[model samples]
Target: MISGLLTGLSLIIAIGAQNAYVLKIGLHKKYVFPVCTICFLGDFLLIWCGVFGIGAIIQKFPIFLDTFRYGGAAFLFVYGLLSLKNFFKSSGSLVAGNTVSLPSLSKVLLTCLGFTFLNPHVYLDTMILLGSIASAYGEPGKYFFSMGACLGSFLWFYSLGYG
Candidate 1:
């Protein structure tokens, strides 16, 4: 379980787009609750799926992963171009950034969901990586490991959100 906790933390602490976005919104004090909840839930569900059975199934047939990877790549490429355009259009100052109107709740929710699901690395981390590790623990041990990992994820996302 400790191994699972540490491994989960190690994987998540590597400052990905999700983490950076979480920190960005957190610092801005906008939609922090929904953002954190969605992210943790995303991790929770994926880790559970991986720990229980989806991980092995995915291992057996990697095509699903490949599909997600390719689709996510395309999505990310478009998202990156949009972000670049936004950056160029802005004055590149915090004050100017703040002048923009509040985005809708639905938009915030969807964006959070996108950050969770649109990134292929997330699947690899929660499903393939952590799932592979939990397998080493065997039945009952794997459950404990899964719980530990979930707890770690919960801690990390909430901390980043509230801190």
Candidate 2:
């Protein structure tokens, strides 16, 4: 369990599209709970799917991986362009007291989805790598390992989101 927790943390600690989005919205204090929930749930889904052999299934089709790669790249690119454009503009704070309105909840959630699922590397880490590691534990131990991993994911997302 400890090992799984460490492994999950090690994999997730790196800053990437998902984490960046979480941290950005967290700092801004906009839709933090929903964003964090989406991240944790996404991680939980991938981790469990990986433990159950989805990694092998996914690997069988390289085209699927390629599609996610290109699609994720495009997603990040567009987000970057939007950020750059907004940087020059005087969009007010997302805080409660601010006069400038927040973006629609639907749009923010959609962006969170892109950040969470569109990243192929996240699949590699959570599904493939973590799943492979858990399989080595065999039987019930694998379940324990997955539990620890899921707990780690839960902790990291909430901490980073609400910290």
Candidate 3:
């Protein structure tokens, strides 16, 4: 369980759409409850899909993963470029407006959801990665590992939302 917790934590800590959105919401403290709920539920669904063998099925499609890798990389690069552009354009020469806004709750929620669901890497990390790791354990170990994954999702999201 401890090992599982560590693995889950490490994965979730990495930059991703959900984490970015959670941090944005935390900074603005707007619609925090719903944002947290959506984030947690999204993680739960991904983790569950991973533990339940759905990940294995996904691995069969080599082309899909290849395509996803290129597309995801491009998206992240563009996002980074946009941030850099904003940073340069500002009079203070720094990026801002990273926080969530009360008026943009719906937009934020929808964007977060879309990013989470649309990104293939999300599945690659949570479902495929976690699934592969969990498969190494025996029955009891697998159960505990799954539990740890679930707990990690809740803990990370709750802390991120409130922090």
The candidate 1 region of ten consecutive residues with least summed lDDT is: 93-102
lDDT of 2: 0.87
Each prediction's Cα lDDT score?
A: 0.85, 0.87, 0.73
Task: Write one digit per residue (lDDT tens) for candidate 2, span 74-101.
Answer: 8888888987887789656434345554
Among residues 3 or more apart in sequence or in different chains, the pairs in candidate 2 whose N, CA or C atoms overlap within 3 Å are none
lDDT of 3: 0.73
- Those runs of model 3 whose alpha carbons end farther than 4 Å from true positions after fitting are 91-103
Ranking by TM-score: 1, 2, 3
Scanning candidate 3 in windows of ten residues, the lowest lDDT window is 93-102
Order of models, best lDDT first? 2, 1, 3
Winner by TM-score: 1
lDDT of 1 by residue, 35-86 (tens): 9999999999999888877976877898998988998888788878987898
Top candidate (lDDT): 2
TM-score of each: 0.90, 0.88, 0.77
In candidate 2 the C-alpha lDDT for residue 83 amounts to: 78
